[model samples]
Target: MKRNKYLILILLTWSLFPFCWQVYTSFSVSESILNPISQIESRWTLDNYIQVLTANPPFWRYLLNSTIVGTLSTVLTILLAIPASYAIARLKSFSKNTIKILLLTASLFPYVLLFLSLLEIARKLDLGNNLVALSIPYAALSMPLAILLLSSAFQDLPLNLEEAAIIEGLDLWQRIRLILIPLISPTLASTGIIIFLFSWNEYPIALTWISKSELITLPVAIARIAGSSVYSVPYGAYAAATVLGALPLILIVLLFQRQIISGLTQGAIKG
Candidate 1:
């Protein structure tokens, strides 16, 4: 019992530590974040958030950009992946296995290697300073996993239903629209939420490519809290922004928890 209690305490601390620090820091003034020995409770103020949120470019704009990018990326990813996943699942085509392998292999490959290439492409396309650049990378990054997940859901569905529909002279589109989409919706939703989180939290790419301050995402805006210059960063506002940034994800997970749980648990094992 003692061991279990200790382990639980350790896990809770590990999980909550960052949030705790963020909350403590967010309430801290700009001076405290810069000072190593600053007392946590002594430096509380609303100025950091005020400064961070109302700076020349503003944090609210960045939050909006993040929302747009995350939402659009998730929507587009689902739209594209759903049809492709359905095709791969149902069509026993010659190239189906190869496509799946390629998707898996690409997903396994680290995104680090392609950063330079993506950067170059972004510059050429004039997408470097815009949210569009991040959206493409986010979609590309998520596609492989989406395919794999959606494939499982599709496979879990009994083939007889498909065969029956075909026998009744239902065309491919009809079969997909009528039969597959409805059955595998939970898994599809899971893929969408996962992709949205990836897009929402992506920081490194945003840092490198986003030069216009107006195009800042939440992560980059929060980074500014630590100060790029020798100037002090406001910790409290950064904490608030962090909380604000996290709220959507929390809601999404909570809202979909049941479906995600049921779908993943009952998902198809065999193709």
Candidate 2:
């Protein structure tokens, strides 16, 4: 038991070291950041955060943009996945298995491979620089996984409850709305969070779609900060930006940890 505990502690520390380093670097003076061993009088300062926040267009703008995209994408995924999953769950075994297999294969395909084609489609649709429109691709990319998760959840639900609803004169949509969704809500919560996180941190697609400075997502904005000057990178400011960018995701995970755990546990056990 002690050995297992120590092993878990070590693994956690290893995984968290990078984030801890970013936090430490965010507060440190640039000189101290550049020379960690040097004994400097001003080892820490708030100037890094100040610089990041006070920059033109402001740091929070990127965060807000990311939030918008993530939220919209998650909503779109849930809206589309629920009905599709329900329909799939009701299909014959052979047909259902084939569709699930196809979705799984698509999900396994590298997203990067689709970038060029997606970019072309975006241009044809004139979706470039549109924040709301950006969510379409995000939703599309995440759809397969969402469908798979939601379908499995729908499959795990008791058929008797659905039959009972039907006998009570509830239509298919009504049953799905009032009965099935509530039962599989935990899976929805887990799936939504996963989709939101992906949209929040997505870079390549956002980079290609959003060229406007004020409209850039968090990842792109941070990348710009990192690459602002190749010769003398603003490590402290970049660290501050990274830390700030990570804060929302950390808070979200902390706040919804119970739902996340319950949802994932139920999905794993039931599915």
Candidate 3:
């Protein structure tokens, strides 16, 4: 146990080294992009965070756009996924392989292949480079994972509880609403946090769909910092923005850590 503990500590040190360096670099203001050597060679200042927070392009707008898109996308995806998962787990009206195939189809379908089609759909729908377009693709992309998770949650739930509810004269909706949903709520929380983090960190769809500067997500804003000058990028601002963008996910992970780990572990064990 002692040896295993030491090994885990060593692994954790290696894992956290880069993030520690980033936190260090984020406080450095030297013109040399705030690297390890720069940390050793120069003095620390708060200017980088200040510049990142107050720069003309304004990082806050990116935060807002990302938050809006991430939130809307996660919520809509979870809502859509819940019913689909319920049907798959409870009804089984369709073949299980067919359900799996549809999920795989949703996930494996190349987004790039359908880019222009999605663009036209976005334009026709008048969603137009904001949360709507970002959310649609994000919802589509995240649906598979959500279904897989909630379906597992639904299946893990003891059928006895469901049957008892039904025996009490509760119909399908009441059984699901009063029994299944409550039982699976922890799993739902886990899935929501997972989906939120995925949506929050999504990059490709954001780049493809969003055009206007004000509408661009934090990832795009951070990319703009990479092009701060015609040929040069401020790695300092890039690193800082990365840390900022990750802050939300960090808080969310911490909040959901227990339930997320429990649900995933239980699901894996069951599967």
Per-prediction CA RMSD (Å) = 3.7, 1.7, 2.8
| Candidate 2 to truth, TM | 0.94
User: lDDT (CA) for every model shown?
Assistant: 0.79, 0.92, 0.78
Task: Give the per-residue Cα lDDT of candidate 2 at 64.
Answer: 99
Error of 1 at 262 (Å): 2.5
- lDDT-superior candidate, 2 or 3: 2
Enumerate residue pairs that collide in model 3: none
Among the numbered candidates, top TM-score falls to: 2
Residue range 107-190, candidate 1, lDDT tens digits = 788888888888888888888777876788888888888887787577668889989999999998898888889877777778
When 1 and 3 are scored with TM-score, the better candidate is 3
lDDT of 3 at 132: 69
Work out the TM-score per prediction.
0.80, 0.94, 0.86
Clashing pairs in 2: none
Question: Which candidate model has the greater lDDT, 1 or 3?
Answer: 1
